[model samples]
Target: MAGACVAALLASSACSSSQDASPMSDSSASNASQKLSGTVTVFAAASLKESFTTLGADFEKAHPGTKVTFSFGGSDSLAASITGGAPTDVFAAASPRTMAVVSDAGGVSGTPTTFVRNQLEIATRPGNPDAIGSLEDLTDPKLKVVLCDRTVPCGAAAQKALDGSKLKLTPVSYEQDVKGALTKVVLKEADAAVVYKTDVRAAGDKVGGVEFPESADAVNDYPIALLKDAPNAAAAKAFIDYVQSAAGQKVLTSAGFLKP
Candidate 1:
């Protein structure tokens, strides 16, 4: 009777241990799945905000298990962040010059592709109160013109256009980014500003855009790339491929970007 009782106790203990081990195995599998389920962070240019946001949502819908997160700002600033280790999986810059900074820093995985192009436009207060119609008009002594600083892509393009046209503009303020320049015009701080065409469209009723012929001389190309040290390389590559697809091009084009 004693031996039988001891045998029963040992069997019970063994069964309990087996049941615990089974859940432990399941937990390990669950952890692995969780590891595969995470967000892919993207740093993109501010001009790309509208299009990229639309694409990000589409990407999430297509890839049910992955999340797409974005941080949009000036291209130069975005490149600086990637070089500084901001934990980004992908980067989309408004200029090749800015993308080169990341390439030089060994932050990008491969050659960045030109995904889209953008041109500068003169944004003014709605209703054309100043009757600003041309790039040469911005040089008017009475107009309070604003421009983006030379450090940003839009600023560089604006400079090229001005140089091409042999026109000099003395702006009331040199804003930090294209949007900032547009804001100056929107707030009536300046009578006009040279900002990206996309920005004017995005601003909707806040401002009006006037196209100039010299803009053709200074079209800026936007580039996109996956980072070399991306924590989620697979997802990053997928996102890149998606951006270069026809559907992605449609989204960008609809938002005023020129297909590359």
Candidate 2:
């Protein structure tokens, strides 16, 4: 009887152990699977504003109590802020070259992933008042042109496109970011601006896009990564993963950003 009781007790113990390990009641497991709730601050390139804003809204809706905040500016400026100790969870840059600054400083959690590719487009006022057709058209000098500052990714791509065409352009202004350059056209302050295809798309009828052949040589690859000091690490990872998901691609591609 004693031996039988000991075996029964052991059997009961085994059952309890197995039950404890099951998915139904493990608190750690529950936490991992539970809906994440927190604010995730993302520092992203100015050109990503529209698409990222849409994705951020979708993410917040899907996660219930979660929220996403963004600081959008030039990719170089954004990277500088992240490495300068400004608090942020994720960094999405207009180019892998910009993201490299953060990765090299150990400011990111893991390897950065390219999420999209963008090509340069000539953004002209509605109805294309300047009647611009190609990269060489901007050389007419009668039209006021704007280009992103040479320090930013958009400017870099523009430079490459201009170099490919072997055309020299002296713009009225070299704006600090793509948005700045795009804004000039949107506001009708400039006749045309060399910006991203996505920028022109987001601007809608406010601006018209001109695809230049030289843009082939200046495609910009955008990369994103979770920051090492993310305040909401779990939420940040989920957001980064979400941006790489099919749903995110739908939003990005719709806005004229190409697949990475």
Candidate 3:
């Protein structure tokens, strides 16, 4: 009886040890001991709204007692805000040129890393009633087309594509951001608008997307950096790490963003 009891006790101890070493258990232990807290403020491009919002939630969940705040707008505007003294923890821009705006001002803590790439696409009314097939279609004088301002990344990409194709387009209006440009088509205020493909996907059935080969020549590389005056530097770094992690890539790729 005593021998049998000793063998059973040893088996139970091995089972307990196995459970403690499990991946789930290790993850729980790591999270419980994680020192991250406070809020991480991110200034990002408008095109990143959907994916970044989802990432923010995931970050908060992964680190309890933490919060994430975002200010989404044109990368150029966000860069201006950063250089002009916005107290943000991180900056994710749609283009390297826009990121250079802040980096040149000595506002970045470290070298900015490219996280993704985006391409321009024509966003038309749902079902593409106008049957706009390519960039040339947007040049029709009768069509009310909108574009992002020449200063923004999407606008710059669109302009590059147009220039490459030797196409001249006179838009009815130029919006401040990609979302704003897409909204024109979604609201039927414009027959079409040149914006990022990711924005078109985020709009769901609200808009239709038309791809142009010239867009290939105008793809933009997105970069992210930690601010020199970050209010929550530690959390900011963690958030950046998370964004570049496999899990983050999955979320971004699933949202139609291209891997860097």
Best by lDDT: 3
Score each candidate by Cα lDDT.
Answer: 0.90, 0.92, 0.94
In order of TM-score, best first, we have 2, 3, 1
Candidate 2 lDDT, 97-201, residue by residue in tens: 899999999998988999999999999988987789999999988989999998899999999888888999999999999999999988889999999998888
What order do candidates take by lDDT, descending?
Answer: 3, 2, 1
Which residue pairs in candidate 3 collide?
Answer: none
For 95-213, candidate 1 gives per-residue lDDT tens digits of 99999999999988889999999988999899889998899999999999999888999999999999998999898898877878988988889888999999999999999889999
Model 1, CA-based lDDT? 0.90
Write down the TM-score for model 3.
Answer: 0.88
Using Cα atoms with residue i matched to residue i, what is each candidate's TM-score against the true structure? 0.85, 0.90, 0.88
Report clash pairs, candidate 1.
Answer: none
Q: Model 2, which residues run further than 4 Å from truth?
A: 1-23, 26-28, 31-33
Query: Which consecutive 10 residues in model 1 have the weakest lDDT in total?
Result: 31-40
Candidate 3 runs further than 4 Å off: 1-34
Best-matching candidate per TM-score: 2
